[model samples]
Target: MVEVADDRYATGSGASPPLHAPRPEVEVVTAAKRTRRQREAATVITADARCTPVLVRAAIVGKARMPRAALEILAPNGAVIGNVALPNTSADFDLHQRFWLVGDPTPGSVVAIVAEGGRQIILPGSRLRSGPAEGQDWSGVACRMLGWERRVAPTDAPAGFQAVFSSDHPTIDGPGFTKAVRRFRTAAVTIPLVFFGFCFPFLFVIPRLVQSGTSTLSLLVLPVLGGGLMTMWSAHCRREVAAQAELVEGGAARWGKEIAFTQSYWASMRKPSAAWDGPMPAAAV
Candidate 1:
């Protein structure tokens, strides 16, 4: 049972407790093997999806508290790999999950006690269970392990352990937005350039011609055409942005910004049903 210094951690709540010992169900693996981070990630937030209530004892180390009380999980590279949007009504969470682990005691560091397909994993969720879209029914409570105040339990002990996480979804089973992102990448750059290209003629060329007192009527067509094209290009860029948003909406991609949620009313968390725990027998949990 390793221990982390209390000062090394911070969260929405003040000064969390010292780390808890690791769970017996955790999976320990080496970094050399391929990871299961992408596979076990939430594809979509649905009631039918396997829900779990494993305790999460890690300290919240995000840059700031999310608008909806969400705890954004960061990867080793700091790119978002996953997020647990608290059961806030306005938040756009694609999936809700929870986890905890004990391994490294270094404050702010992640311990990979749980593993999936050889990859270390952690559930960064609170049992304030919730989802997007109205009429969304949840298991009633979204639960997450908070604080290091070790609570002695008879059969099941509750302790907050440190298991770090990440967000920013990756492409599933394919070229991971290679084509879509590429197309938009081109449009983002080209559209702006195209608009300015036309502006050059309209601002300079047309103005000079008009000043010369030449029959500006015929040349007026250039500005008109340019203006039309610019309008179309602007529209195209906006549409692309919408399309991108749609693609990542559900669990396809991960977000790095604060997501709004109907202020998650803080509450006590109950035990969650197991969604996924590496190599654990059903009877054990």
Candidate 2:
């Protein structure tokens, strides 16, 4: 009887079979494609509009760190309606930052996030996530990110209208006023210190030198020179204070305008038939 040799058991001159079948060679190309799609989806910006003010969330990823990135909300006509600065991110990681768009975006509008290195991401407004903002603690996040100068609060109006106003009022005890006062006090204190610092050496040295038989007239020149320098420094300090005061005044004016605009905006939103007709008034300015 012709019997075939048991080649399956033979290992001396032939390669042995794998203990288990290879995991049907993982399709690297297909897997890569799937990973790419998932990453693209994850990085997309999503919007939430159930609340009064619209909010947008972006998941930024990659090796680049964009410290100066800004989110720009565009109208359907391509005009920039709102811009929010994003927080800093480290290299080779993902960061999620959200901002409330100043005004509602119409359908077909787009959102773009521009990074410092010219990297920009554009997302269509159609990718909005439908949900209510009632349970979400978005205020806390806004306060942390936008600071007191630009914070939003819920209003007593119906339909859950919200108001965006600055906490830096122009009153005497307000943040803006207090900051200006502090800067003035700093300048007041520094002016005297600088004057004394410049005169200290001459005041003490000249007296001793005069007593030691140095020419009294020559020593007098030193104090006069020190006085001249102190005068120049004082004038410079005064100019600096004036410039700072101008800045404070300008900021106060801006603060007032913002408060007024917000009040008007809120009033308009409260109307039954009123809709966001255009971008924020402040944004236009």
Candidate 3:
């Protein structure tokens, strides 16, 4: 195991962490309600679109450096975009922004997002070779020393091509996409049902029993009825299940070997660990 001699994660205070780049476009307004770093990160992604979209293939890399203060987003003109704090995740990234691609660079602009600190983001036409980070890798490792969990070999891209996460990139092109679809299916079913089941008694049974306190039988019957209602609701949501399955099939068709990588990452970021109400890490980049 590679020991982080300078394990930034070792700290408990609201200090910066190891790995990733910083945007020079924005000034950190430590006065804001968020950690100084998080606020600064959010400001960078949205300001001047400091993250202007380009047609670049992206790959993850890690480099050890003297930990810098949470990065600042720099303006194209070399001025700070603004002095403000922000939520951790990229402000505007949504279902449409996350994707993987295998094609030429296309004309026109899309929003580039800053996520997972500054290290995780989409670059334009990078053509970086990719392989697993924490898990096993069949391909040879590039550099174990650099923190970049994955290495992307650069490539020259052609013109007039485009891909979107929901559309082209799902065709099972790589591990990223494969993980995406699998996670989506597992989470889609688990998340809602888990929460619904937990809340059933308090939200439904208790209320009904309270109103029908007139009879002891109401207590027993209401509980059963609530359970039945929950079962019915789950049954009624088969269409949602089908939709998830369809996306799984669709991703394989669209991206080939890759699954829905972006979707999965997004889901993980949004999902609470341990419990539904458990606080999540600032959206994993």
Best by TM-score: 1
Which portions of model 3 miss their true places by more than 4 Å?
1-214, 244-285
The collision pairs in model 2 are none
Sort by TM-score, top down from the best? 1, 3, 2
Candidate 2 ranges with C-alpha deviation above 4 Å: 1-208, 250-285
Pick by lDDT: which candidate is best? 2
Report the C-alpha lDDT of model 3 over 1-285, residue by residue, as the tens digit.
Answer: 000123344468667754673322322212223343432333323322322222221121222111111112233344332111112222222222222211222222222233323323322211211221222121112111111123232344332222232354323334443444454445444655665676666555566667766565655664577557655654434333334334434322332111122333333333211111111123321
Candidate 1 lDDT, 172-256, residue by residue in tens: 1124333443344344445657767766766666677878887877786666786686667544544443344334333211221
Error of 1 at 73 (Å): 9.5
**lDDT for 199 (candidate 3):** 63
| lDDT tens digits by residue: candidate 2, 33-66 | 1223223322432332211223333222111111
Error of 2 at 216 (Å): 2.1
Candidate 2: residue 107 lDDT (0-100): 29
Against the unseen true structure, what C-alpha lDDT does each candidate score? Answer: 0.32, 0.32, 0.30
Of 1 and 3, which scores higher on TM-score?
1
